[model samples]
Target: MAKITYIENGGTEHHVDVPTGLSVMDGARRFTIPGIDGDCGGACACATCHVYVEGGWAERLPPMEEIEHDMLDFAFDVKENSRLSCQIKIDDGLDGLIVRTPPRQY
Candidate 1:
């Protein structure tokens, strides 16, 4: 399992263990971590799973595919670090991943 930290807009933090092969969105959903709506249920269709990867973890993540890039366009407060949590597959290498949710989804 990989450990992931999720931060809400007001700075609330949730630490979760994400099993390998599941996505970060899965971890948030499993723990009912507030802020990640995951409207599309990990289909990579909606950007409600949007998050900003921080603490240098962004570089460790795989480059976003064109589909994910286009999807993020619909997210709130998109940033260079913005990523759909569903697009980030949790693995041992991502043990200490950290990300922050935006103030709102829309």
Candidate 2:
């Protein structure tokens, strides 16, 4: 399992042990982390699972696909490191991954 830290808008942080082969959204759900709605589950259909991956960590994740990029248009506060948590797969290599939740979703 990987230890992923999710920081909420108010700086509240949640650290969860996310299992490999699951999406980052799933990890948030497991811990009931606020701000990660995951409205479309892990299908990447909704932008509700949006998150901002911390700098340095974004480079380690896979390049965003066209669908993910398009979906991000519906997310609030989109940044250079913005990503759909549903599109992020947890793995041992991401043991200390850190992500930030937006203030709100569109």
Candidate 3:
């Protein structure tokens, strides 16, 4: 399992043990972590799972695909580190990964 830190809008942090090979969105959903609505599930059709991947952890993630990029365009408060949690597959190497939920998921 990987240790994932999810920061909510009020700056509250929820640390979860995420199983390897599952998407961050799935992990969040499994733990009922707020802020990751995952409105379209893991279909890559919604940006509700948007989160800002911190610089150090960002580099460790897989490159975003065109579809993910397109979806991010619709997210609120998008930043250089913006990513869809559903697009980020967790792994053992990603232990201690930190991601901040956007102010608005829609």
Q: List the candidate numbers ranked by TM-score, top first.
A: 1, 2, 3
User: Which residue pairs show collisions in model 2?
Assistant: none
lDDT of model 1 at residue 40?
Answer: 89
Q: Give stretches of model 1 more than 4 Å off.
A: none
State the lDDT of candidate 3 residue by residue for 1-106, as single tens digits: 8999999988999999999999999999999999999999999998999999974888878899999999998999999899999999988989999999988887
RMSD of each: 0.7, 0.8, 0.8
Residue 54 accuracy (lDDT) in model 3:
76
Colliding pairs, model 3: none
TM-score of each: 0.97, 0.97, 0.96
Ten contiguous residues with the weakest lDDT in model 2: 37-46
**What's the lDDT for residue 14 in model 1?**
89
**Candidate 3 Cα outliers beyond 4 Å, as residue runs:** none
Q: Each candidate: what lDDT?
A: 0.93, 0.93, 0.93
lDDT of 1 by residue, 1-106 (tens): 9999999989998888889999999999999999999988999998999999999999999999999999988998899899999999988999999999998885
Error of 2 at 13 (Å): 1.0
Cα RMSD, model 2: 0.8
By TM-score, the best candidate is 1
